[model samples]
Target: MKKTQSCPPPVRRAALYIRVSTEEQAKKGYSIPAQREDLEEYARTNGYAVAGVFVDEGKSARKRYTARSAFMEMLEKVKAGEIDVILFIKLDRWFRNIADYYEVQKILDAHNVAWKTTQEHYDTETTNGRLYINIRLSVAQDESDRDSDRIKFVFQNKVSRGEAIFGNPPLGLKVEDKHIVPDPETAPLVRELFRHYESHRSISRAVREVGEQFGRILWLDGTRRMLANPLYKGVYRDNLTYCEPLIPPEEFDRVQELLKERSIRHNQTGRIYLFSGLLVCSECGRKMAGRYATTKRKAHNWEYHLYRCPTAMQYHRCPHRKEVNEEKLEAWLLEHIQEELNAYQMQWEASASAPVRPKVDKAAILRKLEKLKQLYIDDYITLEEYQTDYQKYRGKLDAEQPKPQRPDFDRLRTCLNAEFQTGYTAMSPIQRRDFWHSIIKEIRLNTENSPQILFRV
Candidate 1:
């Protein structure tokens, strides 16, 4: 018999992941092309076959992993068993969040795939290596957080000085030397829109007329937002003169009053919904709105109050199309209010008996304060950052240490002891609305039109 020739092992396929945030791209040798070159060279030296190159430009590793398109694509390749390994220039290039790293690591581990950084040594198989990787990740995350704080501080200072931040300016405005100025072309149209809306008092009509006259289609929501924006009146944040005014302050104020007066929620229909904002649709998790319908029965007109999912009624997206009658809902609650009260009372007693005091690591806060001071001294952080962090940590340490105190449940106990139905019946419509709002956090309406109450008490 001829001896069987043994087949050689398959070559390890490597997926190269390159990422660079806008800030990191300005640094030396941190660009996407530079990272790709290094990772490809590393893969070749390790005798691994190059599978594919994935690049996510202007994306922060500190951001959610799913937000990075290339990163997610690499994960899909790994899941499909098309890639045997993932290579990057450094662990920070892969992930700055330890939790996100572990979450993706689980998928990689299941596929018998591994990751390696060309410039950083991390071995997941060894305990020490894993701990080191975690420490490095934490350090990277701290650096990212500090960078974010510094950016926010700079932006805040700019806003205080009435300087525009990086982004497209809103409608009727243009950016000039990092300052917001009126766009001569769109400013006139915006002024016309506001004046037309003020006279007509109809967003739909204003949008249609403005789009027809200016040849620019204005979205209903965007138009509403523009009408309410303080920037149109040269006010941004707390700065009253952030930009050149497109609409006068008095005109802006008048438009705001008109908006409030024309709002559907503020319309006086002489009908009060006891569970106006309390009812939630179980299907879409949107608030159920109250509406009324009139029906003629035995030559007399009767008005029926009903609660239905607004998403289903307006957008037709929710599956729950059935309307729940307010009378039936009240009856159901009256029947079960005693039971809910009893359960809440028991919960209250248990919590009161053993109050839980907040646990704070005072030592950890002190250590952070010391580290912050050291960072400031070493010029790693600016004076503003040092002062902000110092005050924040000091406030955490000096604020009145929270003491456990039992909540007063006297009102709840009284409700539980009395006939809740009788008291609920005696209450007026407005009183009933306030009462339901006070006790019930939400009333979820299921597909079967069944009411499930979530009580705050």
Candidate 2:
């Protein structure tokens, strides 16, 4: 029998992995060098050549395995059977995900490479050794999942209570130990903007003109669009969630009314509405009471009522005691309303992912997207959106490509659309909640004297 030369001195090519998430990086004992030294010394003492020590300093293991560059490359090597063992200070240091940790171990094991955590004193080659690592990874992963869930739970609780999280506080705030404190500087600007906007129904030039008064201001059209963001009023939202407005219906209706009238040329001070605030006295600025006078019309053969300034009749010296006839003003206002509403550019939807025909599993699509998200925190969707809509279109083209004997396009789309409609209807209650969370865009009420339509970023 061949002795097999003691299995070529156990091959002994080792890969060392060290990681410190954002929290661990802030702490002292969890230093990278200390872990690296301990891991490297353990490898050397165990007759293993340190092929390379993988150091993923300041990376989150809550993310998938491939996110850490060194660890990813190390996995590729492990799969190639280039390393005898993958070493870590402990199981969590290796991977906080059992799915990823054991998955990689299986790849290593299949390629005749063994994974050994020095501190744990286990090797994957034996069944008893595998059991120790199974428990270790499972516990580590459970803790990691729990920690992530706990953080998310805290954030959700804050949101449910209408608290701000992790952003520049709305125009009225300054950060105070993770809470929003009203800022004397920015608060007044916000108030004035809201006041003027509510009165005028103009957001086009208003945002730019108002922001220019400040030393530092956000002039981006997108940021300008946020002027009407309800989150500033303290709200939280998530995707497709629904919640009734906390504000009075009248106040909310008033804001909505303002958004409808905004236009690009609205800020020009050429015309003013005399009818505003029930027609004030030209001299005293007191609100004039409304009165109706019936008149006989000639050619059209009609009776008409007109509103006159009551204060004018009350005071004899008033020069502006004019009664504006209804027909003309009604026509004028209708024209204005028509013009404003018609002035809206067509709302073009960038193709709904170029139609994911036949394989109409929206759930699968969402799951795949989630997986992609786990692989990369930021996705091609955003990058594609930023780089070129054409790139997204091209991606849609790929997604839209027809496969042989796939489901009928129309039928699949119908089914999917029906499901989406059902979901949308169901989501109405939570829409308000989701709106606060996912939508970073501002929904400005067009402060122009137009109808109540909203402008969104």
State the displacement of the C-alpha of residue 322, model 1, in Å, after optimal TM-score superposition: 18
Distance from true location, Cα of 116 in model 2, Å? 2.0
Residues 1-457 of candidate 2: C-alpha lDDT, one tens digit per residue: 8665543645578888888876886774767888888988897687888898788888987688878898888878877768877788766777777778767766776787766666666656579877877887788777877677558746754654445577775556666655555577777676666655554445644576667766546554654455556644544454212222333334444455445423212215332232323333444444444334444567545444354445466765555566555445435533443233233212222233345466445455445544443433344454333335433433553465444332223432332342444454455422422322121112111112122322221
> Model 1, 307: alpha-carbon shift in Å?
13
- Per-residue lDDT for 236-343 in model 1, tens only? 874567888889987797688767644223337778777777788999988788889899999999998998888898899988999999989888887777687667
Give the per-residue Cα lDDT of candidate 1 at 97: 92
Backbone clash total, candidate 1: 0
TM-score of every model versus the real structure? 0.56, 0.44
For model 1, the run of ten residues with the poorest summed lDDT: 258-267
Displacement of residue 342 (Cα, Å) in model 2 is: 14
